[model samples]
Target: MEILIPLTASLVLLLIGYFIGTILEKKHYQSINDREEKFINLPSVTMTYRAASKETDMSKYSKTQLVSGGVVVSIDYFKRFLALLRNFFGGRVSSYETLVDRARREAILRMKEQSSGADMIINVRLETSTISSSAGDSETVDSIEAFAYGTALYK
Candidate 1:
């Protein structure tokens, strides 16, 4: 009888813990989604303008070029950070999904901004780099760069 009582109590506590954990996880996901959506909505610029030349004029098409620029406004290392923390806690990395999603969104935004004004941006190349980072045992940084290029057209 004594053992049964203790086991029942333990089970109840475990259930409570599970419920709380789930609630917290849901909240976290919601917050992340909101934040990511906001960032995605930030005003962005589109650069470069290009147009294809006549098929007969290979030289013009070959010489056609447009310059597009995009700034790496944000570099979030927190995603990797959360993953590391989860590893330390011996838990699956459910928390890093947000980070991954954010990175992809940011990349697309940067590239889109760079190619925004181009008549038809083609042969786009995206480059990601870490421009600078604070030196510290506990400091980490992640950055992304995007480059878009296309032929310019003017009537």
Candidate 2:
């Protein structure tokens, strides 16, 4: 009887977290999709642009600037619990996958927004890191951050 109330309470909290997280994630994904479509025409140039930037005809471009974007996304408590279980069983942690995907995509979108009028973005790169808290002897994962950076050329 004593364990029943606590167990039921924990289950309720987990369900609440899951539903809220799902809704929020869906909204964010929709936003990402829309923004991606909005910037679909923007070309992400590679090393070729890097070489072009150094050409003698630099006057062709009105501006060349560096653009970057980064965001930190946190997982809901329910996801944390699932990740813990996955760790115990030793398999792929799928929840973390979405967290990372969301972060990376959001970062790229933001970078694109920064270079809205640029003809092309060149030498793009992405980096990710885990945000965690360490107090005394305990460490806990809090969030993950994704950063995107590139050079933009305005013509």
lDDT on C-alpha atoms for all candidate structures: 0.46, 0.88
Clash-forming residue pairs, model 2: none
Off by over 4 Å in 2: 51-59, 136-141
Per candidate, the number of residue pairs that clash is 4, 0
> Which runs in model 1 stand beyond 4 Å of their true positions?
1-64, 73-78, 86-118, 132-134
RMSD of 2: 2.5
- In candidate 2, what are the lDDT values of residues 114-146, reduced to their tens digit? 998998888889999988886643538669999
lDDT of 2 at 118: 95
lDDT of candidate 1 over 5-96, digit per residue (tens):
98888566656645664565466557546655644543333332222232223343333345444544332333444556778888667654
Model 1 TM-score, all chains together? 0.38
Model 1 clash tally? 4
Q: Which candidate's TM-score is highest?
A: 2
Model 2, residue 20: C-alpha shift (Å)? 0.5
